[model samples]
Target: MDITRRRLLVLLPAAAVAWEFVRAGTPESAPNYKTSEHWWGMLIDITECIGCGSCVRACAQENDVPDGYYRTWIERYHVTDYAIERPQVESPNGGKEGFPMNEDSSGKNFFVPKLCNHCADSPCTQVCPVGATFVSPDGVVLVDKNYCLGCRYCVQACPYGCRFINPKTNTADKCSLCYHRITKGLTTACAEVCPTGARQLADLKNPKDPIHEYLRTHSVQILKPHMATGAKVFYNGMDGSVR
Candidate 1:
């Protein structure tokens, strides 16, 4: 059998993991989904984001995200006209209720949403002692909540600050790209609720997806490129001041 890299991560045999999934109540079917045929990512149009918090609210409701912690959040950036000034950033309560009025008149403000980059070379996966964190076949970095050790190694290893210890589950948690929904051919909650369509669920392997056309003709960048983590979240119309 041609097993995927993700399936091989668990110490137990493939059949055993499948059984565990069944035990954990994960759905057994995805309606003809083939992970190898899809590569998941996100395209963020920073210019179109209105900081409305619709995405944040939808993700919380959809995933049951705990308060004060965020799987996906937005940051407001105040980039001044002055060339050397650093951008002022804020995300009060993970920006779930929209942002406060910007008082700085000398600068322009924009919103940047942040989430798990789902890096192909994710350091979180490398740091997991129990193989609980792994990259899925479709390129999304995910945690095996049932198997997590609660050691917090993966959380500490993540450069993007995406992972956190789920107080409810006592395991590492972050965005899974809405795996349950996407496997059934549905968009992520954040993407679906984005009022301006600024955030889009992208399938890099699908040639017909608009992401390919956008990437070919527009300037896009991954966060902290010097780390070389192979982050999949691509940002467009981003200012250099954004971290």
Candidate 2:
């Protein structure tokens, strides 16, 4: 081989390009992934929650959520006797720093973690004028930031108060059930970080999923059944006072 200066220059650039591609890694591909084969949901055991706020912290860190905004959050409910219908709720700093000791002797207090319900008939998706927010075939709702108009319509349409405008993108954002991770066969950050195993990722289409057994054995309910949003998030041991 005759090594020349001109040949070295061309080889060096080609090698650099090849190295960059190698360093970037191959994009994950799932040839067998069938969206119809999956129906995503979440199971939350209210009784198992310790109000520790680990899930909230993990969600923020994983998603790069802006300060003063939350893709997921925890609410501390104080339901006093005889006033169960009007429970006082507080989520100071989205309960990321944990909650104060319950001082109210007359009421029962508990923590409830909140995120997108990923409803089958989500009002958020219904109100998107640009169709930027949509439910995936796998049942996870996602937002296409590039197509979003940032009109806040989805935010107003969501009954669960999940959607928020991202200051950096100027688009509506909410929990996607960690679609990026789920597609790669990983659980959501919140579920992964829950100390008490209170949060669980469920796949309705998977017959072997534990959610089926949990539903059979536990009395679970979705928030606001009256709306009939077809919400998939199931909560066990939820207090009647929780709104």
**lDDT of the candidates, in the order given:** 0.91, 0.91
- Tens-place lDDT per residue, model 2, 109-228, is 888988899999998899888889999999998999999999999999999999999999999999989887887778999999998999999999999999999999999999998999
Candidate 1 weakest lDDT stretch, 10 residues: 23-32
Error at 138, model 1, angstroms: 0.6
Give lDDT tens digits, candidate 1, residues 1-243.
Answer: 766877666535877877876665634552667899999999999999999999999999999999988999999988778753588889988899999887775778899999999999999999999899999999999889999989999989999999999899999999999998888889999999998999999999999999999999999999999999999999999888888
TM-score top scorer: 2
Query: Could you estimate the TM-score for every candidate?
Result: 0.86, 0.87
TM-score of 2: 0.87
**Looking at candidate 1, what is the lDDT of residue 20?**
71
